[model samples]
Target: MTTTFESAAKNIIGAGNRLDTLGLAPATAGNYSMRLADGSIAITVSGAHKGLLEKKDIMRVDASGQPLEDKKPSAETLLHTVLYEQYPEANAILHSHSVPLVVLTNYHSREKFYHLEGYELLKVFPGIKTHDVRVSVPVFDNTQDMEDLGEQVRAVLKDRPASSAFMIRAHGLYGWGRTMNEAAQVVEALEVLLSCELETLKLKKR
Candidate 1:
């Protein structure tokens, strides 16, 4: 079913509040978006705190990331746009700066991807029926240039079509799904897994 801009905006706002409650968004540290009925995208505006997002905080943009309205779009809008381009079924994208993501990405040393396996939560992601499945979440170096970062992400994802999410080293996580609810679920599930991994490492060190 197609969603209107008003409905999409409400969804984005509600998602922001929910993520904020989970401590995933802090100090305007995240952005949210949803695909509208008209093929255009409704995304959070730049500098609007996700925790306090309002209808005005959501704005329309073309598939190419050009703003359809007067509001300025998020700087990382290209990242969301690239996902939409790659996954035609994805209607919502959520990016969050959480402690678990930052700590885990910074703590890891030798890997390009962090693997999450053997957890029942692994099934929270799409297509996985059992915990035996392994999921790799790619970690890319953080960059100030969103364009360059977007290009890097697009290149990395070119062949790994099954990837549902990724992380920016010392930064945050990006998760997407077919709908806002699904997207939110993925983000929450990944965050929980990351936290578990971090706690496991702490116990190992002890």
Candidate 2:
């Protein structure tokens, strides 16, 4: 069944509440989107608090990130669009901000990628069947230029097609999936894993 715009809005609103409750949507720090059945995107409007989003806060945009309505989209809309274009199977995308992610990425700013291994939570992402695997999530420098950042991410992902997520240095995380439910699950799991990594680092320093 093709997802209608109304259905997409509801799913996005529900996701926002879930992410916000999990502390993944701090302030107005994150943006979310769902690819509609008609090929347009249903995304949260710019500057809207994810936890408090209403139907009016959701808007539509073309695949190129151009607004299909009179409202403004998120500043990082291109990032969502790029992901949708790169992975046709991706139907939902979530970008989140968290203390653990912000701290870890900044602390390891010199590293190009962050590795998650030996965790049962790794199975939350698509294609992982065991905790004995290593997933290298690409980390890109934060910038106001969405086009540049999106291009960098696209380039990196082109070589690593299995990757389901990425992080922004000192910024936050981006994760997507074939459905809204799966995307939310991936984002939540990533946040939890990042928190664990932070704890391990703290213990190491003790």
| Candidate 2 regions with alpha-carbon error over 4 angstroms | none
Give the lDDT of residue 90 in candidate 2. Answer: 91
lDDT of 1 by residue, 1-206 (tens): 59899999989999999999999999989899999888899999999999899898899999999999998999999999998888888999999898878888888855789899899999988888999988998889988898998888889998877778999998999999988999999999999999999999999999
- Model 1 bad stretches (over 4 Å): none
Score every model by TM-score: 0.97, 0.98
For residues 46-83, what per-residue lDDT tens digits would candidate 2 score against the true structure? 99999999999999999999999999999999999999
Where does candidate 2 have its weakest 10-residue lDDT segment? 155-164
Tell me how many clashing residue pairs each candidate has. Answer: 0, 0
Error of 2 at 43 (Å): 0.7
